[model samples]
Target: MAAFNLTPSDPSTFILNGIPGLEAAHIWISIPFSTFYVISLLGNFTILFVVSKEQTLHKPMFQLLCMLALTDIGMSSCVVPKALCIFWFRSKGITVDGCLTQLFFFNTAMTVESAILVTMAFDRYIAICDPLRYATILTNAQIAKLGLLGLIRAVLLVLPEPLLLRRLPFCPNRVIPHTYCEHMAVVKMSCGDTRVNRTYGLVTTFVVIMLDLTLIGLSYGLIIRAVLRISSKKAHRKALNTCTAHVCVMLMFYTPFLFSTLTHRYGQYIAAHVHILLANLYLLVPPMLNPIIYGVKTKELRDKVGKYTCRM
Candidate 1:
């Protein structure tokens, strides 16, 4: 799947040797990514397995975790393989169509992840703020509906990105700066006036991320209010403990996201490497840390994972 407009010169057309120190940097990229992939795979897979095999773990929070693990797998799938191939295997050039496809999935996974994180927050809010009705509020049927809705919204919300890219013309200089087909990176290559692309991209980013943040914040705010109302220090501690994983996970995603955007505009190529480093870590770190955080902090997931693993 070559770019419709650009002819491939060679596999090395986009290799990093041209950049100063990039040849040496490739080794750094490859090693860290390789290690992260292993950890992410193991952690996410264990979470998925734990949630799937144990009926006790089938609550709304774990349900969201499973959705998150699935999204993490998709997110890693979108970037890691191509990145590894580029750095380790020296397979650099990707067709424009291939780039578009990758961008779509990456964007989709990102949007889906934001929604999943929000859903998890809502789940926590319900459990903490309305303990008695938690079961009724987050029944299996309701969780399933949320899962399906998240998937649908993920794919549907980001549809405009790739569609808009398809209409834009790229007259020349089809080489993408980064290894994978990031939306902004791909847009920057367009020969056409990219005001529309920039508008859509920035708007899309703000809309999705801000919306997710608002909902998550609201849920957390209510949870905090409810926790404060409860006088037991032990109960307050327990409630905060449940939220720790989600809070860490949200910060992990949002901080790098905002930094990457800032780096994109102000930092240019110099920030690009940093953005790539952050993006890779964003996908790998959260997934790797998520299950560990949950298993360590949430006793039920931990015990279920241990019990299921022992059985296997």
Candidate 2:
């Protein structure tokens, strides 16, 4: 049997590229990617593990942290393992169904991650803005409902990509120039007119990203406003201090994402490898850094981590 079933009506397989025009460096490059992937897996897993075991940590904020950790694990696992296989073992063949599966899960995880961040921003907003009513506002049930809603929104928005792609006919050279099957990367392989795919993708991305960022920005704006009202220097410092981890995570998550989106839309003059690297970073950086940021900046988590590690 052929490695890739080349059929215009229904291509059976797709090829993945480690990094376009840089196959020689793929092995060496996998070093850092592998490190990020491992750190991401372990760090996020640790967050989940510690949060789940500690009754004291079962609050709304920590619950959101668990959700974020789960999203990170899902997103990272979707990309890095397949990428590692490409870089290490030279296994780049992915079936159509498999590619679509990867596409959906990756997008779903990303959507969930974005939505969770917005919720985290809201959590911070309440924590800073209305401490007296925080508990009343964000009960445990409400937090879980928000998490579930995020998953639902992600599923509904991302469902069209694969379904649309599956309807189109794929031409020959069904090679994806990136490590994993991205929605657009896969869509561009179709011989059919992908106006619907392109339009929906652009709209969905802009709507989700812009709306999330706008809400996050509005949230911090309010947070800053509330923080400014603190009468004491220590109180002001404390308020800002609590938000430092969230702010760091937000930057860590959005900066790479913004760069990648801009590069995709306008940085055509830049190297293909640059686009590939940025895209991977858009997913990998946050997962690897969010836990570390929280661990360092959140005193509760830091103290808990210290105690846990000391016991180990």
Best by lDDT: 2
What TM-score do all the candidates reach, one by one?
0.91, 0.95
Q: How accurate is candidate 2 locally (lDDT)?
A: 0.87
Residue-by-residue lDDT tens digits, candidate 1, 163-242: 88888876455566576777787777667888888888888788888888999989989998999998899999998988
Clashing pairs in 1: 3-96
Instruction: Give the alpha carbon lDDT tens digit for every residue of 1-312 in model 2.
Output: 343344333357888977998999999989999999899998999988888888889899999999999989999898889999889887878889999999999999988988999999999899989999999999989999999999999999999989998999888878889999987788778889999998898899889999999999999999989888888989989888888888888888777877776676678799999899889877788899899999888778888878888998
Which lDDT values do the candidates have, in the order given? 0.78, 0.87
- Tell me the number of clashing residue pairs for each predicted model: 1, 0
Name the weakest run of 10 consecutive residues (lDDT summed) in model 2: 1-10
Candidate 2: lDDT of 75?
A: 90
